[model samples]
Target: MTLAPAPKPAVAPPSPHPRRWAGLAVLSASLLLVVMDMTILNVALPAVSADLRPGAVELLWMVDVYSLVVSGLLVTVSALGDRWGRKRTLLTGFTIFGLASTAVLWAGSPGEVIAVRALLGVGGAMIMPSTLSMIRTLFTDARERATALGVWSAMASLGAALGPILGGLLLEHFSWHAAFLVNVPVMVVAIVAGLLLLPESRNPAPGRWDAFGTVLSIAGMVALVYSIKQFGKEGAAGPGPWIALAVAAVTLTWFVRRCLGRPDPLLEVRLFRSRPFTAGTLVAVTTSIAMAAVMLLMAQWMQLVQGHSPLETGMRLLPTALGALLMSPPAPWLAARFGTRPVLAGGLAVSGLGLGLLPAVPATYPWIALSLFLLGLGMGSLAIASVAIMAGTPPQKAGSAAAIEETSYELGGALGVAVLGSLAAVVYRGALPPAPAGGGLPGPAADAVRESLGGALEVARQAGAAGAELARQAKAAFTTSLEVTGLAGGLLMLAAALAVWWLVPRDLDVTASHH
Candidate 1:
């Protein structure tokens, strides 16, 4: 026999244990809960307004405060996770979030609700970054990591899609309080599972928590988000919004300079030097802006305009969820074959197409399912592209990378709702004639009518024939405004798609690049 070559050293096989997967399951469940809560309460806004009697500004705050705080704190909390063990930080966050949910349920005033929502945001900041960081630690094998991330992404998308359904069910059967109360059971389960299953992990070079950076980040984000919100309410050129934006710019500039000088910064500004990373971040931001506004508008149309019960409205959205579910499983395969850039660009175009179709959906259109399915399919593709980008990032910097990605998501969403929602409000007001001075309306009711479409409708419903005519006119105006808003959102998505085509490389494999 030909001198047998020395047997090659055997390579060790991967671990067969299920514990690692269980850890991911626990983390994914926690993430699902956090993301679901972000939008579930939206469907219940009408109920909240009816019970809490919030002003227009207060109503906007109730919807946006959680996002603002979460976005502001993400970079800081993500840094904290690098210093402390990710598991410990995540568990602590879960506890805080659960308790805050209870507080939200019991909140008697709009201000109290806003405060609790902000607290929930703090917890969310800790939780979001930790989940992605833990996933990085749990799966060392590249292929396994991709699969795990796919599952996690699917759950996140599902949770967002399901929020309206769950909220609608709760509102139809119980009260608006039930929307928040629902989080309690989910959180309790997630916390228990996390403690039992999660393995602790931390960065080897965990740096000091930058307190000053934290303050600057929070202040800058709050000012920026608040300014955008104000711009939506008062227009972008308004003096008040302009002032807020200027403050935000100054604070952010200072924060960036401070980070550049620090040896170990809270947010590593160097990350953006990577073209792929920067492009990915831009894609995430624009995709969120494109989709979030549509979700908000659709919810309003289903509940306030069409008079559909919350449960019924949610049921109608089932097609969108189904489409997303179907799309998620194939994401990894598509990325592997086509490469991330092409897949991402294609997805953006598809999403833009779907959004463009929305403006054509007639009031009496019976094909709601088709419209939602198309939208979901497009968005689902974009979601996979985002995951691909994150997974491609360096392991050591996963937390910061995740924070950046999430911040873009949150900021984009806030801007979308503020800008698109404001545009719709302006058009609605312009189309409707002013209410009569003494049309048997109370001062508060008349004032509210001037401010909110929903409030105006409620007033009309309760005030008799004259009020009914006013309601009719207002409804027509609202519909027209929604159509215009949808067109604007569609055009923005188209622009984003073009941006992706121009910026992202055509043949780049995100997975291979990182490896």
Candidate 2:
């Protein structure tokens, strides 16, 4: 008798462990340090410039090199972690990051500082991918995974908001070096806790490292980001900037072609064929661009024009941090009940509305807090929803998917600063009349004149009443330029919302699985 096939072995649900939560805490803390560093230095840039005395070109490099390096290496380092053990790579990254922070703290010149920051980026590239990849290994249940991701997203948002505040406090009490030194203590704790709590996990069928792909990816990103940086400083239509951009396009095209032909590729290009993955990536990219530009422009407005201290600026931004924190807990439940499409579309539209109000900000506006709160709420909802879609992808492809999401986020930020910043620059330039005959000023004061109306006023204030008229004109011009930039950002965010509505699917889970 054909024996009834042995009853299929019962599949057991993954066992929940208390230690997993501890591991998450350790990972989140490490991630927070990296996120904090990105913005903390913005407040410290002037100090750094004074101490190092870097030239104009060197100053820009010192500020941007870290992000450029990090953006270039993320995919390569992520692929490395998938092949090697993610836990092992993460621990190594933490150790390197600590050492690099120490190097940055002791740096004597602009070149030295730039080198150390770039090293930090290399370490960060290793750390970033491991955090998300580890979550996949630790939590197998969908609901639990979503909850953990929500917490992770909140920590990232909080770290970003807290960076300037933390930097300001350190700068007030100590030297500029304090910013880099601060990471050492945090890294020590992370390394110790991570070693004890984090479990080792690696891909079962991880392919060999693709060295050519690595080179191509790095070359393409650096070229593209560098070109954009040049365009912002110059103009996109400039011949030199166009040449750099063309080189970037060629390198990226080569990289894509290489990936398509490889039996085992560094990045899986096939994943983009999935509608959910593609749409989620687009949303992540566009939202990040819009948000980053707004934050940079608003921070400059608050500090340079409104004359708020860093701490005061951060306090004013509490609406954003609190909004994100409050919205995170309910994201998973909302997505499950209402579907990702509605949530993403609604979140983007709400964020657009919030941004739209900024252009109308009155000199005596009392509703600043409320308007910012709305913006924060919308950003929080969109961030959580986009991340959920990304994380829901299949396990085997998780590393590549995470890399794509991160690449889009970082690239978008770079582009935002480049494109939107250029718009602001143009308006600012046009608002100012050319300097009068015999109005020649020294380079430092001249730069101050170019940056803000307050700087111009301060110059005029020191120069006496003869310069008062020029200062008034500068103030009016600067205010008008800021207004124009704010309106442009709002319109861009609205456009992004429409893009999301058209592209993202109604059901993330089904789309993820099918695609």
Candidate 3:
């Protein structure tokens, strides 16, 4: 028999775009816009409340509907990006975001504002995943990609802290409309930059885009998020929430099964079969949950208990952002020197340590500063997780991988607010003094007082001495609840760290995509 030469191993194609770093800047900037939008409402809500005079339900919808729509549409948009083109999808998103934000100038009612936010969510859903997938295609080398993700992560951390500060600054001199107006200009610039610099990429073998699968994913995610939000607000007593939860479970399970049965799935969930991808996703989810819970409670503590101004609270939050900025770039270098498994597990442990210390702090600047720094430092692992997810995924499937990672974050954040917040609520209700039905307060007011610390304070202000005493008890109860939330979050982080360590391969290469 004639000897046949063995085929040479396949090598990754050289990046088609030379202006990689510049493209990264565009991606990072786009990501910053998306992350900031999630939080910018915090300070603007009071302004909106004053201007719109919305009913309580209307106000809640205005605050929450954006996220609900974003989470709901992420999977669908990401899948479409794979079929059409990531660059094309992203630029379209920029156009929509800019137009929607600019249109906010005409918003005259709470319903109109809610519609605007939902439109913004549509743009966000399109933009967010494209950013990550574009990064995957832009940076061909692993180490360079890690560095890029470091910058991406820093921007995310910075954006969260920046939102309140920016809102406060604008609301100082301008109307609430300025908040949305800011996005318009920035998004316009991003859209133009993206068109000039970003290269088109798509799945070379993308199959039929199933509308039914898209519907299932969107419905499941929206229902699940809404169910969680309602449960957090009112606890688990309503049939509406129960029905939504059931629908979400059934719909998501069916969707997953459909993907598994397909030759070219809507999402390449089989990627999770690789332990590294699975570990990275779990880490993403865990960090998001921990950070969300911590940020919410800490912000409340600063404003309500410590009596800090909005500007002062934002300034106090700088340490956390600073720590993330300082540590993120170096994380990739550290992981390369050490092993990926060690770095990931150790980072989570350090974060858990911070959570453990939070409840014991004296609510002073120095004490809170230490915990926040630790939390940010430990968050360094998130960059590593991003690297792992992208590196492990095929370049063609970047959209699916990006969608999965972002979904983890979105769901994690929502659950964090729901589950941990609920746990804190339970502790608060239990520790609070019993609200007698007819003792110096009306039934409606008493029920309101029991609902939240903010409500308690409002009632106290109206009731004078009686309210003052109730407020005192309420603060004490809130503090106790904070303790429970912190401690429980710490335990969960520790558990996640341990689980990741055990599941991740000891010699796993975070940079190279083996699986």
Reference-based lDDT, each prediction: 0.77, 0.77, 0.86
Model 2 lDDT tens row, 373-398: 77777777765554554555666666
Please, what are the lDDT tens digits per residue for candidate 1 over residues 67-169?
A: 8888888888888887788889999899889899898766999999889888888889999889987887787665566666667767777888788878877
Query: Per-residue lDDT for 1-515 in model 3, tens only?
Result: 99899999887667546988899999999888778777777778889999999999999999889889989998889989988999999999998999999999899999999999999999999998999999988888887888888889888888888887787788888998988999988988998899899889999999888888989999999999999888888778878888999999999999999999999889888999988889889999988887888788888877887788766777888787887888888888888888889888888888888888877877567977888888888886668888878878888899999999999999899889999999988898898877632366887888877788888889888887656678788888887887788888888989999988987889876665342
lDDT, residue 276, candidate 1 = 65
What TM-score does prediction 1 earn? 0.89
TM-score per candidate: 0.89, 0.92, 0.95
How does residue 214 of candidate 3 score in lDDT? 89
Model 1: runs farther than 4 Å from truth?
A: 1-18, 52-58, 104-106, 236-238, 430-452, 466-469, 513-515
Which candidate, 2 or 3, would have the higher lDDT against the true structure?
Answer: 3
Estimate the TM-score for candidate 2: 0.92
